[model samples]
Target: MESTMQLLNKALSVQRAAAWVEDMNLSKSAISMAQKRGRLSPVLAGNLAIKLGENPEHWIAVAALEAEPESELLTRLRKAANSWRKL
Candidate 1:
């Protein structure tokens, strides 16, 4: 699964990402922060997924998974997300 930052980078150029951040009412540094950290907040991830015409819940799960340390639940959630994507 791609990280939320990766997804956003693939979908938007630097200028467009800035514009999107502004449009979303996020701080000017929001995208930059996410890029530096290599992840986005779950809310932002879901909203970006919506903007990209994807399932918000799936991307939100992706974001949440990225934020967590590896564990059994994380493994299960990743499997679930992958299965959902197949549907």
Candidate 2:
């Protein structure tokens, strides 16, 4: 079984994570939607105590604390993208 913490909010940037979820090929609109409506933030945040699942601010704070370093996160994203290509 996978730990919830490891699986949840794996990407600090919701836009990046959304891109990953959206087949790892980034869409500009996906980024814009996350900024405008925070459509992806809570899905990334996962298992929060907040009433509304779409709390972008809380998502940002948690992501900052839980996220891997920038280089590491980018590497992970890169690996995901490549894996998608193989599929």
Candidate 3:
């Protein structure tokens, strides 16, 4: 099962996770389960990326901004964006 950290890493957008759940297709309770349960939802995070039509690696980069809205996430995101472009 994918850990919460893994989901956070992949989605790059914690907001997307919240949104995905709010979309009525999923639920926060489900997310909580995925997070709290004994790794049954390992694929849930990856599934979220697929459902969002996003690349898994980039998903966390996209969501990282939301993950840390008040601090260095933005600066780090900028640097990561520059780095990503170079690659």
The candidate that wins on lDDT is: 1
Pairs with backbone N, CA or C atoms under 3 Å apart (clashes), candidate 3: 1-42, 2-42, 11-59, 11-60, 12-59, 12-60, 12-63, 12-64, 13-63
Model 2: residues >4 Å from true position, as ranges? 1-20, 23-52, 68-87
* Candidate 1 residue-wise lDDT, 1-87, digit = tens: 367877787658534866886788988888889888889889989988887778889788778889998899888878877766655
Among all windows of ten consecutive residues in candidate 2, which has the lowest summed lDDT?
Answer: 1-10
Ranking by TM-score: 1, 3, 2
RMSD of 3: 10.2
Per-model CA lDDT versus the true structure:
0.80, 0.43, 0.52
Model 1 local distance difference test score:
0.80
Ranking by lDDT: 1, 3, 2
Summing lDDT over every window of 10 consecutive residues in candidate 3, give the lowest-scoring window: 37-46
What's the distance in Å from true for residue 22, model 1? 1.6
* Alpha carbon deviation, residue 41, candidate 3 (Å): 2.6
Evaluated at residue 82, the lDDT of candidate 2 is 53
